[model samples]
Target: MADIERHDYDVIVIGAGGAGLRAAIEARSRGLRTAVVCKSLFGKAHTVMAEGGIAASMGNVNSRDNWQVHYRDTMRGGKFLNNWRMAELHAKEAPQRVWELETYGALFDRTPEGKISQRNFGGHEYPRLAHVGDRTGLELIRTLQQKIVSLQQEDHAEHGDYEARLRVYPECTVTELLLDEGRIAGAFAYWRENGRFLRLEAPTVVLATGGIGKSFKVTSNSWEYTGDGHALALRAGANLIDMEFVQFHPTGMVYPPSVKGILVTESVRGDGGVLRDAEGRRFMFDYVPEVFKGSYADSEQEADGWYSDPDNNRRPPELLPRDEVARAINSEVKEGRGSPHGGVYLDVASRLPAEEIARRLPSMHHQFKELADVDITAESMEVGPTCHYVMGGVEVDPDTAASGVAGLFAAGEAAGGMHGSNRLGGNSLGDLLVFGKRAGAGAAEYVAGLGARPEVSQADVEAAEQRALRPFEESGSAAAQHPYALHGELQQVMNELVGIIRRGEEMSSALDELAELKDRAGHMAVFEGNRQFNPAWHLTLDVANMLLVSECVARAALRRTESRGGHTRDDHPGMDATWRRRQLVCEHRDGAVTVTERTHPPMRRDLLELFDITELRKYFTADELGEVTAEL
Candidate 1:
């Protein structure tokens, strides 16, 4: 035992993003001693990178907007594969969550009448996103960070102590979930700065770690999002649902290889940007699917007209959901309609006024000007799809946000079922707020009812410590595989084989390649002796998680032989009828990953009635519709 330090808390929240902050805040309100552990500095967690806004049907811009409409739009955007209960709760609670942030001192852009401004986003039926220009997420993090400090002030006042009841462990990475028998007891973690081991003994654990985007070669996610929470939950015997659905956002800067996968916020289109091909043709008009046919404009004239008139004209095709736009961009590039940099052109110059573009999307303007040396007000910028988010993660109960394992709660991008097969724009931020609070409240309730504090086994702690040091020991071996090489190989494998387009043969080949990569990762090593801020050593651990998540993604993609939401099969083509009723879930079996299928949970009677029966026929079968109606 390498002198591992141990601490105790009522709850240990892994990850310090928007979800973790909200969950910790709620946990503290229940009088629980909580600890937050993250791989980065507190507020810098990926939530700060969110640019667009938070989706909430406040109806500020459109009076007809409400939760029911939001719910319908979410279901439709997800291809009706969403957990209706989760969607219902998310749609119903998001508005209040947004309003609650204001109470925490989050300022939003104001309308002419002085209410929080709402903006249009892809797949939303109305202007329903509560925003702060293009930096809504910055306001969110600043507010949550301040609220956490205020809570600590109150706690210290009550206890007459310097440190509050809640604690934060920054620049730490959790390696294992310490389980007592079958339930979560604590977690084994290590600091990134010095590689010292830590044992967090807590009865309840909340996983709010974000997503798996870092597994791809080109991604919008940061280094921390290597599917840590997903891999940790799987190792702890929790099921990962819908692992195949990866969201590839349509607009990423394609030039300047150094900044290739940087996110181009969808706010560009929501604020009236257009997607044009090499020949100056607006290409999205030819790609709208039947599900969103009437909602998008059919011609350039109609698309231009829709910017000013809200009720009569339909939305421009540029504002279609990300899945549609990503695929359209992929197809256009493949057919040689791409820009000089192998991406489509995003033209705000042809749509919005220069002053309006700079006022609304200063980040996008600055990003292009600083990175690519292209003035967004003067010319169209090259953009392409980049791996952005994963819609799959630990499956949780709709109401409680509890995983299948007791005392294990998940929310935000770490948890699945809310978005189903795909997530619409702005829903991710709302998810962080809505479910973050619920997971906190749920974990607090579960803790109050527990018999006693669970104990962490000494043997497990020793094993974790030993494993953490294995890379340093193996660094001198002849067969020592460089962690960076292995990591790059993993990224290349995933991006080339199992990327945006999938096929049966390609996915099958990816499985065999992934197995070999997993073997190499098991023997991965780093450079001699440096432990402080050693990125190479850190990648050795992160690659393990990426390999596990990559296998799950490729396996699930192989199994689901249809196109729906974020998952599209090149061979099988369109959405298959039989596949529509099933949700692909993954588990770490005896020694390998095993995938299983389960029937999609049916929606409640009242919620089903909110959608038009004619539109219901798109997803459900006649018999399924009858079963749903019979319940009423």
Candidate 2:
């Protein structure tokens, strides 16, 4: 309608991170024309920032490790609220995904026996993470990008064009998902560099955009993660499950204001680092809750012994799941046992030799040295809770990765129910590999069965263009609100009230604040400048998405009335078994975000048998257990 560039493909993928890349690879390999769009440079997706390894039950480091153990640990780590089917598939298939990466030329760190080496992480019974030092995410992204390039090379050799079947559009942002009669028809996006509108008409779409950490004041997420995919799915009429459960990673940098909230990888603890307070006391032992009591060591001697002979001793309490550890750090700071920078001390110097620390965690060593000017191999580093991951996202079919909408699918952090409430440290990478492939394959199958391809409407394209230009129209007006100021206020509201620990009253206040922010966002404007590379214009779009998704989070958090994994309530401090059986589903209706309670399907009987009845009792209601036993 407006002379916009338009292209047609079988599948359009949003967010060129680990999930997006893997999904594109799968779809292209299946002989489908795939387009990948990203908000950053081709290889600079947020996946590169991941320091921990990918979780897979390879059993190279420990013979005791297998899919069942990994599955049990994952369910336990999620406090038993996970989608059992998704967790089962992830645990069973993760090893194959990791091995498949090797076929694509990934070189993981190997054991002395010349097998892929797996390392120990929180919530897992044995060494299970396949890694490359502490920069495992970088290697995964590198491998996937290489695979995509190889495909492009093959296409060039045959068709005289490198992008014959697959192409990547970097520095582009999708502002709206166009629908045709309740099915995904296409997407409307704008190039960030030139600020030009483009339309991608496709029968199916895969959303792999990560999380919503940028909505909070302090977070480990990069600026690209503003709930883009989540907001898009909701606006396209898909339901989001567990929007209240946001993960605050236990160890983010807390010193040096500029570097605060940068992630300190869980690799530090996996490689024998410990947590201490200002008085040099190992305080994590006191924070282990009853459900995890027997699984963790009670004494320093026992914990230290486990590092050498893990078969005989329990894991150190410092290696507890992220939610528990984050809460402990929050308590220490509140009680004045914090370091000078208002955080606890994460110490590796006393536990491992300097060279060993460097060898195991090179990225962490360099990150601390350069970002905080601290030598992690010589002293303890100040660390605290920082918003990192969101366990809530688009509700999808466990096998197909299909959302409620016919042609829409989601994977990785943008899809919910895989992690339930809290994700294990290494599971995020595994999720991208496992589910990304599923979504790509699923989309291909859907495309194959389609009777007619959905068409992008000209009216919808014009509306999207008008919406993108509204900020410019509001510029220089007397009542215009600066996008930066509005964004800062939104982040402050989320970080303070609806953060790691929550209360009903605070969340109610957050809802009120979000309502006001939404009104102000309607008048948002940027500084006078050309659209090309205009940061204020970019943030104006991001702020709108953040406002919509933030309201989903606040509304769901206020409704959930229980403490479990990532969704901890201060007023209701104990995990509720009944609540475990229910899920909070968020959907946009009549121009407002509304959350409704829904019961998740029961775990399959075979999966239920993997857990001890006593362990199941901790999270399952009596009636649910009866169903489990009856089904068995």
Candidate 3:
């Protein structure tokens, strides 16, 4: 490691998405030498692709909306499987984080009273998202990038060069995390542009990488999301929780094969769009479960009226949590009520004027017009489910965002247990912001407390280097298998078998397929021998990560027999009391995955008091309910 090209930093933040950028900001602010390393360009992380807004209890639209209500909504959205403390912190700290972003040059859509505008989304009792129309994520990334540049400018003026403290290494892929005595020492990465391997030695590493969406064929995620951080954390000896809870966003573009599976932001429905079958029937009312009783409208008229007067009527059934809506759409298509493209119809044209639709959802309007040749303002657009996010990730502490491994921290989508089995729409942005700063601050505090830096041995470096160069060795031979072909196979397997709805036999078959793919992935090779920006070489590493992650997803899904938020089993259609109280944790040991069930600890007495007896009875066993009530 010392002989190779090596650099030193106090902290190295991996995955420059919203959480990574935010973490880098916090670490730099604390005067720690920080480096932000990302697989893509600084501004192109999945955070920029987020079309929906940021969830925060700003209370601008509904004064009664507070952290307490937001907390309850989030807990309900996750079906009470969420970590109550994380929900509490996210709800309480989100508003301040959003407001802080505004100071860093973020502009939000303003309300009539000149406050940050709020909008309604599924599972929220009140309008809670503070956003900039439908392009909130773009604005968020722009603001964070601008802040990074501003910091660099300040550092240059104070010192001689910009690299003295904070620097960004874009187009770099971290292949392996270097460890010293089972703790994080640094990470080994390659420059995506030149294929040159490099190492960064740091005492602390923060993982802000996003989800495993691209493992499935129909996904809103970009090519960068192959679960690198998830796999990296596991290999670094950190546990991954709730690996089966993959989120299929309800409204992905379902028409025009070229534009298939692209996300249609939830802002459309928030602005008064309706979901209908081929018969123009609003069908979500039939799918509401007893747990969400009295939370949504029962009639079309009541639902429509509630948009204008929310206090008087319940929310529309079309605005149910993503899981409920996704399942209903699946049922509608299965029942032969689907639209022309095997999707349900989403009609904003009938609800809002052409100009209003264009202004509120400019990206979606243009996306459909340019890609699908459909005018969202004039006709209903066809939409169905697509793999959008994974609620599961590396398990971390709520307050500090620390994984069990020392000097290793995870935040944003990379860290698990915030959303539980399902995530509420717009909660993604909020989770990244709240935990990103915490992870960064935690890393800084951790580095300060360390007595000495961990040592990196040459044996670890040489082994990693040999593994990375395997593509070049296998490229020229006739036995070579193209990495792209292997990637396509992985995506197809994830989509067809372990997709939206699950069955025991199908997932078991997927696990078997994944095992073979893992062996084949090791034999993958690049087309060109050269390392400079070789797409095939990149896929070699990506396919391995995707294969490992796919195994975790499939194995965990098979183990969870009961139907819960994202890990739904067709055979077990209802939530079972036995499985509801536990989560499956995955670890890579002895070249095989080892999974174990861990019971959720009891929530603090204060947070438990937020739920009523009725809600408690739904999730807990009689003995558990008795303990909760006794605490109350």
Candidate 4:
């Protein structure tokens, strides 16, 4: 018999992303026995793929920048549908967190004045993203990994539960939630290295498993982002909020069909790049506001002038918000002014000096050379939108990061309502840090006060046990479906029907196709041996999670009629006032999914004084306005 191991912990964190690792560190510091689990290699858990910098109010580049301004910008960038409390907390805490990373030895790019360098990103009013060249994510992860590794030798005797100390398990995939009396008791998972089944018994569990980018065909996110937390929370009876707001980044490379749409970072634009048609026409100015109408210029002189006088012209050639840029690219392609790939040209070479482009965007240059065989310094990149981030996830309070399910909590991209309908390019890193700490501290506190985990019934274990073994019993090899093929089909369905723009018929048909994919998953057969390091076996599990969560997205999209933020519906072109009233919330009941609308609480009274009355009046009316926003 394969050895079954029982690992006891005060809290089990089911991811190793920036959020997950950060949570584990905090939980350990709080005297809780913590275990950080992941399904990929250490330092490569999708977080390393983040190219743009983290958004924080460091006020290094501009002394005028403050938490209040950052908060306002974040709310505005999210189209004012954000959880005001989360935005407030994130804005206030992010600067401190980023500095803490520096203390832990993260090497951020610095300004000539010796402070951390900041850059402009889509939707930010000013330079806000604190970066390290173009590979901010790598620096962040490496810094955290070093910190956690250093802490591994620390004594946990003060906690009185030494066995519950923080430990990391790489290449482990969580299979099911072990609920006791409808409360989170623990979880069961498989280790990819030895193909061993391990049981984690904990009173509190934090799901920071990141976003579900793998659900779509083209995404900037890594393969590990298969919506594991979303599926796990739904199965455990936790409610997911705002599943309809999926953000498609408007600059994925469209070539070679193999890597159909790889993400091209927004920093290229932030550093004075320009978007143009195949005929080299600057197109964004035609569709933008009158204030920004004469912004971009073909010559270097006018373009340089806009940088100094944004009020007189557009902000900058590369400083447009993602929504505006995405629509601009769409119009270009629609009007037959697109490249051979049906995408527009994103040219940074014409504006920035060659030396600066190579130094600031070395990774961009390297990737194109190795993958696409194009030199970005001399040629324009073909770009279009690809599904990148999800604004919706398991609903939780901003203060606690605790889900509706008692023992379950979430953070990072898996947690909902922080970014609302659309997240700014660099805000996600801040969201990870701010909420990751909250979830860890909260989970630790919860576990610290609780008694041992409740009983794990035989039936619960048997259900998961049966599911794991079902693939092995199939007699015919031909009947078994390959995991990659299913994943491909899922991505195609999602990209075609539920893309940046959506229609009622497309969404409805997508739902039908999702049902069929789920059915196909039931009969999937893995011809590869179910041994250690079986990438296919893990792909199978990931596909199941992706299917479950993608269905949640399609169903939620169907219920939301109006076009708001990232969830645009072609059938309903206008943003309805009713959309501002609530968010779409979903929960799995019995064997099916159920979605409902819930009130999006207003800004809390304690913080209402911070917002100027003029801005409040501009957004909300006298009757619709309220004094207190509920934390729940």
lDDT order of candidates, best first? 2, 1, 3, 4
lDDT of 2 at 275: 95
Candidate with the larger TM-score of 1 and 4: 1
What TM-score does model 3 achieve against the real structure?
A: 0.98
**Residue 118's C-alpha lDDT in candidate 3?**
92
Per-residue lDDT of candidate 2, residues 121-209 (tens digit): 88888988999999998999999999999999999999999999999999999999999999999999999998999999998999999
TM-score of each: 0.98, 0.99, 0.98, 0.93
Error of 4 at 301 (Å): 6.8
Model 3, span 1-632: residue lDDT tens: 22456889989999998999999999999999999999998899889878779999988998899999999899888987888889999999999999999999999999988999999888888999888878899999999999999999999999978778999999999999999998889999889998788889998999998988889999988888999999999998999999999999999998898889999999898889989999998888898899887878888888888888957548898788899899999999999999999899999999999999999999999999999999999999999999999999999999999999999999988888999889999999999999999999999999999997997777898899899988888877777788888889889999999999999999989988988888877778877658789888888998888988889999999999888888788988998877767989999987888889999987777877888877788887887767667656
The segments of candidate 1 whose C-alpha lies over 4 angstroms from its true place after superposition are 627-632
Which has the greatest TM-score? 2
| Residue 572 lDDT, candidate 3, scale 0-100 | 89
Cα RMSD for candidate 1?
1.4
lDDT of 1 by residue, 121-159 (tens): 998889989999888888899999899888888877988
lDDT of 4 by residue, 162-230 (tens): 333778888888989899998888898988886778878888899989998888877878878899999
Name the better of 2 and 3 by TM-score: 2
Candidate 4 C-alpha error for residue 314, in Å: 5.0
Supply every candidate's count of residue pairs whose N, Cα or C atoms clash at under 3 angstroms.
0, 0, 0, 2
Candidate 1 C-alpha error for residue 627, in Å = 5.8
Q: Which residue segments of model 4 deviate by more than 4 Å?
A: 155-164, 289-303, 306-314, 475-480, 605-622, 626-632
